[model samples]
Target: MMLSELSRFGLDPFLKMRHMQDDMNRLLSGLGTATAQAFPPINLWLGENSVVVTAELPGLSCDDVDVTVREDTLTLQGKREPKVEGENAAWHRRERAYGSFSRSVQLPFRVDPDQVQARFADGRLEIELQRPEADRPKKIQIKAA
Candidate 1:
């Protein structure tokens, strides 16, 4: 008998996406000393007139992170260190992500380079971009074909 990780959640589209993203992120960014190196998973969503990017960067402060945008690509780079200060006791097992990491994503469309906004809170970086109105698609309803 074999069981899969996704099978645990049954059938849920949102959950499936979340799980896959997590797996891919983890697989790509393995840990250095710890079990895993936190890379702050990211997700991009489209809005009516903009695209929002949210990243899960746990155990990281604004000072340790750097964000750079070039043309249509947004890059995030930083180092993650173990928060457990002063290692003591004979620990048999440790699992966490700690090391330098960077992630860059190319946006689908060129957005308002001036109207971009970013905020970090609760171990998450949220970036908002005001998309160009010209790039948005227009749909026309037809009563009869």
Candidate 2:
């Protein structure tokens, strides 16, 4: 049936088109779920003299993750090993993700690589980066005329 004919029965063609668009969007949205689940989600805090970054690394030890800083970028690399099952065990449900993952974050300002500090505890990793002395802002003296 023609769209005009369908509209004669109190059906709005625009409303139907909107519903079809919404359905298509909902269907395609799931395609990005895998990419959206970036491993070891992180939080960043920027301060006047330093920057702090914290990441969640559950089921991973300090030796499992690697943190690096260069110029204004920070990179995190890690691997999560899958749990070993019995020889005759069968899988019922598995939701946890396992494998190697890497994420890089860009900082607002360059950091002092020599002063960078990282600490891992309780499945969480915290990194502190200090701004270089030359990169800090200095106040200028005013001369009265």
Could you say which candidate leads in lDDT?
2
| Stretches of candidate 2 exceeding 4 Å from the true structure | 1-34
- Model 1 regions more than 4 Å off: 1-38, 133-145
Models 1 onward score TM values of 0.62, 0.75
lDDT of each: 0.79, 0.92
Best by TM-score: 2
Clashing pairs in 2: none
On residues 16-113, what C-alpha lDDT tens digit does candidate 1 reach at each position?
Answer: 68999999987767755444333667899987788899998888888888887766788899999876646565656766667889988898777777
Deviation in angstroms for 86 in model 1?
Answer: 3.3
RMSD to the hidden true structure, all candidates? 8.0, 9.7
Error of 1 at 12 (Å): 12
Give per-residue CA lDDT, model 2, range 38-137, as digits (tens): 6779999999989999999989999999899999999999899999999999989988889999999999899999999999999999999999999999
